[model samples]
Target: MLIFTNNLSENRNVFIIFLLLFYSCQGEAENKLLEVIKVKELKIKPEVLTIPNPPYVHLIESDSGQYLFYLNPNSKSLQFMNMEDGKVANEIILEYDGPNSMSRRSGIAGLENDKVWTTFRPHAIAYFNYKAEIQFKKDIPSGEVDITYVGSSFQKGLHQYGDKVFGMQPLFMNHHGMNKDDIQKHSLVYSYDMVSDQTKWYDVYYAKDYWDSGKKLSNFSWVRREDKLYIAPWYDHEIQVFDMQKEQVTIKVEAKSDHINSFYYVNEIPGTHEEGLLNILNNDLYGIILYDKYRDCFYRFFYPGFTDDEEYAIDKLWMLRNSRPFTGVMVLDKDLNIIGEHIFDKFQVHASSNVFVGEEGLYLSLNNENSPDYDEDHLRYMVVQFEVGE
Candidate 1:
């Protein structure tokens, strides 16, 4: 009996040891899969420019790297700065009423052929030349017969392709008397032809799924690389890339994430605008996708969730400040295969702006004013540069 008892005890000890070894190996494999890339700081000349509320600053680097366009939406002005010394070359005041007036909220689309384009809410696209002169303004008509049902498109998703600009209308109309079926049938994407002065719609099926699932219309981003345009819905794990010439979705890439599938269903919430905002604030996985032409890769700036705690997630201010630390960036090759994933540390980068990939390296805005590393005198706008890793 004593020998039998001794053998049983020995077996139990061995099983416990096996479990520990297995778990330790599993942890190590996960760490190896997502190697944290290193960031190299490059200090721009101090006092070159003062950007108030740095988080709202939108930067567009000229193709020749000779100029930098700073779009300050808060100040309703666009400052053209010399890249060499950061001196203000020119300034264009974006106002509401005048010959040079544009929608104050109309965010910049991008720089193309020495011209900057900005999109006015609902249906206007304004173009400004390098000298800050308004070249022309185009109004895009919503093809919907029910003008009342027509919804606004997102400014960030606006892109100039060839002789036309491509943008997507909101999935659902927030106005009263709108039903689910009406919202689902709304046009997904629109292209305004500069030559014809006509708006055409493209058939994208997943866009219907967005309205059906009650996702917010503003939670989308666009990236154009050469002839291809990539559209990613912030709440969804998939990215659809359309061929500009064909005007059809040629490829669809789905990213793998454990937290993506854990989304809280919008169907459970009431269909009010307030409820929709609450749903997104509490449960959506927000992300932006950008194409890196220099490296021939795509980088996704993803925030899986605001917080694990349900109570803390409801606090708007707390959610905004802490969400950046939890943000993770995933790099994918041109083929859409994920190469690596890196979770940025607190104060390492800000999640407010889009990731800027330039010839120098990857750049991210920094706004942690409380950090010991923060320098107020020299740096009005802090930017961190990271070297891409294999």
Candidate 2:
């Protein structure tokens, strides 16, 4: 009996130690979360005689190093600046008309072997050389009516993937009276081949019954990490993962948030042009999802719910589009599981188009239009890091 009692006591002691270690490790993991380390000021010089279009810096890699490519439509020039140095390393002034004409509505699509690919018009992609001359241009034939975004957004233009490039439509323009047939015929993304000029549309799926209520959705937010594309449509309270390799939506998750789930659908349509603009300014919308390659995590942002009655920057259209009064981000793991959430009680990030991922951490822009230090010429990013807790 004495020996049995001693054995039982030993077993209990072992179990207690095991639980202690388990909880300790669990707590440590919970602590391994997001941390805003510092705010990085990227005082980019206006060297190429062009003004920045704001919140639209294109990132590219070259043999020399990585560069931020900015296409100035006003000056008709493209400037390449190194990440470390705020000065422009190279500039290419383009021609508007002639035999080698580059369209005014062009943007940097891809860079390869001292040449850059520019997408102009709905159906054309032009290639420009280092000497600021158009080498050649090709028109991609789309059988159906397609929408190409002019400015910066997640689905700005076609991106190079292997021998093909792909693009996504952020919203449906005629979603007001969209029928079952319209939604059925809609393709989520289109893939284009430069060599063949052949375009293929993938029949991507939407979150369960996103438009069944006959309400229109707003713009979409997206983040592409290698083969996975994380898309957050403003209408649906969910985020989906599209697998580039499989060419299908592999995962659809509704990681419900405190504020996102409460977003009102676009049930009522604005009658006038001014009313349409007012609708955008007064509604809640889903922003972008930032992927941390270094940490293999995700940050999904959302514009908090508000009404037209709220008197916060309602007069300025640009201000309402980029910087909102209160915005929040929900942190998720690689599997898209919600772990934590943080709301900027004060004006900070330009949620519409000002967040990016870097080697050090996730960079949230501090150039909110409502911010006290808001400078139209300069750009600032707040570096947020994820580290294991002590």
Candidate 3:
């Protein structure tokens, strides 16, 4: 009887051990199910040599690997680099002090047809080739539906729908405050056909009550996902999504913040491909959110600045919010939940400056006040680097 009792006790102990092992393994598997992303720092040097300026880079397909074209529209020049050898291939000036003079503020677009196009303020569109040879120059018509005194907020231009290329024109004027003057100034959207080189303009709208309430047509804050364009009309609490093919405003997303100034589409890389992140910068402390379009989930990130959210002269600040300037490499995905945020709260960065993401890493150019090339009061650019995850 004693031996039988000892056997039963040993069996019960063995069963308890088995249960614990199974639960432990199950917990680990559940933890692994969550998405994980890491943000690291990278060191990258310009392949082509040039004075460290606000640079925009494009990867051109070459016979070998690829050639990265660093177009500095600010300086009106092109900096070409061979990606294979990590060396500067060539640097050519895109602008010339001809009989006509021009002032450009970073609207350079590299098309697939081996052409680079840029607009210099109120009225000039210039096109050049890989060799920096002038192909064509065009002027914006002085008479265009009578909305003059428009201070240019030249955002990105170049809308690509499948095989077709479309140029985007933003006729957005600046208004400091929500005043009566803002109601008079309207924002216009224009599409330039890349093949035929034809320009067409469209009037964007929000709610009728908002429009009648003295709200302005201000969609300079634009971003593209696939072929569709998402624009945030200043002063409106909603973001309107436009379908390029249908030529219609299809979707309107209600923003959590009152002032929806800017919106960025979080692109997919690896672990977080299923869910996308959308960043909307507003006047309040609630800045951005990770939005899962598929699952219909929202995750928010809150970081604030000391001063008002000012977009201008950002490339000029040495320390942002009294801290060392930092750059965001990639969005993070932690256990099916998206995390990780590096804010401009530390340093100011301009949306106009050239922002490039490559196989090497993410590169940013902030306006540096400490540089001797420009006076401390003047605007100068400083380049910085950040690493990405696989």
Candidate 4:
């Protein structure tokens, strides 16, 4: 849509780059990314899902087959539905009352080779067989530092490769606060050798001057493809890559959100409980970076933040204290270059617990609390189908 003169001034070119960056950020990055990035809505329908609970889903490949799992609060167990048939595939019923009980709030880390790993709040990891039996559980291992949180959910949890179990050690800070140097020193990734009972922590932390207080805007999600692990922190405007083969944090790509125009932060620890809750709600965050294995590309989801008095911010506080900011997606290629971005209108699609990627395209929950199509029995998804250019 833009045509330059045969020769243009340097200042003029620099000014135009930020708006249409594909042509100007760098010569190599000009890959016709914006021109080709297209998306349209699609409906999977209730018939395709046939799911028991709502969709706060995690896709996993077990020894038997591929399945989508969600925490069924009504049944008090993880219900795995067959991805192909949409029927009940398997269930992991953990006992919270028995001698070897699991946490009532057991978080799904990851499942591999019929072995499912679950984590507790403060710090704990337990391995469960497909038959709903705990093989072994471990608390925070004896360490030199204070690790209040040891594990994460979905793809960021315990990854078993070779003889070791690799996992995250995200730094969830306390009320006292931490300095920049101390925050940088804390390793956020670790690997445990199951055979030797030894652990190794990787030297990776928050980006320089990246954290506001380390408490708020600290949730992160990741996706591992082959030897490269892609990490998307809650606050950073960049994607950090950890090369498992190299055994070090390698490259970082600057994949900033175009639609999150006004970004906010919870800088100081709030005095009151309600004050802290307000700060948490009134902020923007990068969430759940997902990799589409079929397409060999990545999608980084985000919530464009708004103020307390914004027109479409729902109620005064909002949704059981969980702020439902309008969702957006940044599309990228496997090499980590920003291709295009889709910006949804306010109250269009809900955040987090709803968005996911599939073979067809990125699936977004159309069941917005404010939408007229919202219902209890039938949940719907707006499949962002990518289209080819003429």
Give TM per candidate: 0.73, 0.76, 0.53, 0.78
lDDT of each: 0.56, 0.61, 0.41, 0.62
lDDT of 3 by residue, 1-390 (tens): 001012445533553453355345553221111122222322335544343433455556555665667655444666666645556566666545553333443356545466666655555556667666667665545324443322222234555575344444444343333444344334345554656766655555444455454323343445455557666443454556678897767776654331223333222232432111111222223322222222122322233323335543433332232122322221322111221233442444432234443332233334422322323222222333211111
lDDT of 2 by residue, 1-390 (tens): 001012435534553454355445555233122344453456555544444334245566546776766665565677776766567788788777876666554455545568876666655666679887877665655435455543224334445677676766555646666654566556667677767767777777454466666565656667778877887776676787878778788898876666654554566666765566556656666677777655556778778764556444435655656578778777676777665566775676766664666654566667777778776675556766432223
Specify the poorest-scoring 10-residue window by lDDT in model 3.
273-282
* Model 2 regions more than 4 Å off: 1-35, 39-55, 59-67, 82-85, 104-117, 125-127, 132-137, 143-157, 194-197, 272-274, 307-315, 386-390
Put down candidate 1 lDDT per residue, 263-294, tens digits, no spaces: 54544446664455454445646576767655
Every model: Cα RMSD to truth: 12.1, 9.2, 14.9, 7.7
> Which prediction has the highest TM-score against the true structure?
4
Error in Å for residue 70 of model 3:
2.2
Q: Cα lDDT for residue 320, model 1? A: 54
lDDT of 4 by residue, 92-162 (tens): 77678675476643477776677778776677777778767888666656244577666566746677677
The number of the candidate with the highest lDDT is 4
lDDT of 4 at 120: 68
TM-score of 4: 0.78
Ranking by TM-score: 4, 2, 1, 3
Report residue 18 deviation for candidate 3 (angstroms).
Answer: 32
Each prediction's number of clashing residue pairs: 0, 0, 6, 0
